[model samples]
Target: MSEPLVSIRSANLFTPNGTRIWKDLNWDLFPSEIHALIGESGSGKTTLAYSLFGLLGESWKYDFLHWDVLGYDLSYWSGPFGEELRGRSIFLVPQNPNLAFHPYRKIKDQVIDFFRLGLRSSEDPKEILELWKEMGITRPEEKWNSYANGLSGGEKQRICLSLALLGDYRILVLDEPTTGLDANTEKWVLRAIRKKSEEGKLGVIFISHDLRIVESMASRITIMKEGSAIESFPVKDRKIEPTTEYGKELEKARRFFL
Candidate 1:
């Protein structure tokens, strides 16, 4: 509604072998909204996410790329502009949180580094500690001093979430944020995400294979298959009984979940 915070048009991405993973993508992400990129494995959801942040693997590249995020052409990121864009415009919470941290560094040090890199504000440390408490990390102070290797998978995920939040970028791209969390932790993280969306400080692109979670969290859903978007619509008005193939797939997925 308010001039899409992120816009992509006729974008195509290719693999190292010159295989096209995704092509002719046209979409827009607006401020204060949550958009879900839904698909099964190999559907190119994560690939698109990486492309949006200009982090696509060396083997892959885009054609006719035009990404304007927060009024800047992120698709052409290079040099100083790239550094500035990385810190200010987009923040990514990768799928594997365990890989995001430095094994030798304390959690607090990593958090501080995030701030020092201009990805977060100076007040991030204190705010993150508060979020850590909210995420059910007991003795938050002690946890802050702990190394990445010492924390459990769920704990690591929460730490990543905190880092993303602390950065406070204009847009946050979460790639399967609930991948390894237990049911309770999943709910907790979901609650925190809902709160973040409500605050209206950032737009979110939630990528997940869990259709149920996407149905519940995303305002709009893009159903992708074979590395391309086959359908896009408002989740609330999905109408499970539709006759289209994509709608039928949604129905089948819903039934499987139920």
Candidate 2:
């Protein structure tokens, strides 16, 4: 068995107003695996996505949050190192494309800016255009020069995914990335993701509401609700249903597990 790339154990967080956001959350990710995080909206799935990249602002306090990545003990990464690691090691494709770039800026410029700040790997527009084409963003030339507001929701998402893929980040955090995408487009996107994970040895935290997609892609599943992880099980496990309340709920809600 491969060693885990990242591990979170007994982590707790709270809002600034002292409202508990999550309690005793535990998860593990191994290389070349997809960890699907599924939950209803407002269930803190997005918050967990941000937390993985150390992007959660100071408005939230941690009771005892710690993460171990690649056998290194990173203590919540509250400093410059954490911020750097956020881009270099963990890339986040936010739920809202509106938050990823300036509305007036061209997609090319946004990708350039992200390339500069993140990974610092390359700035070739050709490579960027290739990624755009690969993600099924048609007419790369037109899409590249278009402003964020001009593109539809699905286009914006694929563009975001393309930009994230340009980097060599170890873990890619995608929050509801396939929303608003048509079935064929969504399948293409998922196929691209699978290729990245298998060929690049990348670990992904794929957050989605679609149980079918999760069943197909996730090597393991984590059930979250109202900020807490209630159930976790491996797809390869012989067990049929999750043992926790939320897990059982999910079991009843979706025809999971083959």
In model 2, which runs have C-alpha deviations exceeding 4 angstroms? 70-76, 237-240, 255-258
CA lDDT of every candidate: 0.76, 0.78
Q: Evaluated with TM-score, which candidate comes out highest?
A: 1
Worst 10 residues of 2 by lDDT: 70-79
Error of 2 at 100 (Å): 1.0
lDDT per residue, candidate 2, 131-189, as tens digits? 77777788989988989888888788888787666777788888888877778878877
Model 1, 1-258: lDDT tens digits are 578887888878788889998878887787777888876778888887777756764567677557676676754563357667777677788899888899999988887887877775575557777888887787888889999988888788888887776666778899889876778777877777777776855788999777777777887777778877877777665332334587577658764632
Per-candidate TM-score against the hidden true structure = 0.89, 0.87
In angstroms, the error of model 1 at 221 is 0.3
**Model 1, global lDDT:** 0.76
Cα deviation of 135, candidate 2, in Å:
3.2
